[model samples]
Target: MEISTCTEKMVQIIANSTLEKSLKKTLKEVGVSGYTLFDVRGDGDSGDQSGHLEGDSNILMMVVVPLKTSQNLMEALNGYLKKGHHLMVFSVDAEVLTPSKFG
Candidate 1:
């Protein structure tokens, strides 16, 4: 058995649920192979949306991939965010248990 550290990039995206479809489309256009989206609640400059249901709340999306792909997504998201969409993106180095899955 052998194990080795692999460099991986993971981007966390928290945005309004109203951008769900558009976000997914952006992910595809940015060439993200895999990602996870979840409903979330939190407070920010936009106020609290926990009380309302559906669109009022937020969605959490996580995409893991190579650095190149991550940069592509971030670049696209940068312009999209400037349009006044409530989107926050952050990235971190990830340890992939199954490296082949990401490739």
Candidate 2:
């Protein structure tokens, strides 16, 4: 058996469910090929996110991309923060298989 791994950046964003549509659009605009999304619940400085209500829930979006693309993604997400939206965004080093799929 043979395997290969490539260096990539994993971008994770946690935001309100109401922004799902806009967020998905932003991802495509930033050249992200795909992403994983989950309806998540947690407690943080913003308090408890129970994810039990329609528009009051939270979502976790995770995408892997090239380092440069990751920077672009963060810059785009920053626009939301500037507009007073509550979003938690960050990126980390990642090793991924079939890296071509993530660009």
Estimate TM-scores for all models.
0.89, 0.92
lDDT of 2 by residue, 25-94 (tens): 9999999988999999998988889977776699999998999899999999999999999999989999
Quality of model 2 by C-alpha lDDT: 0.92
- Clash list (residue pairs), candidate 2: none
The C-alpha stretches of model 1 lying farther than 4 A from their native spots are: 100-103
Sliding window of 10 residues with minimal summed lDDT for model 2: 94-103
- Per residue, candidate 1 scores C-alpha lDDT tens digits across 40-96 of 898888889793876778999998888888999999999877897878899999987
Best by lDDT: 2
Q: Looking at model 1, which ten-residue stretch has the lowest summed lDDT? A: 94-103
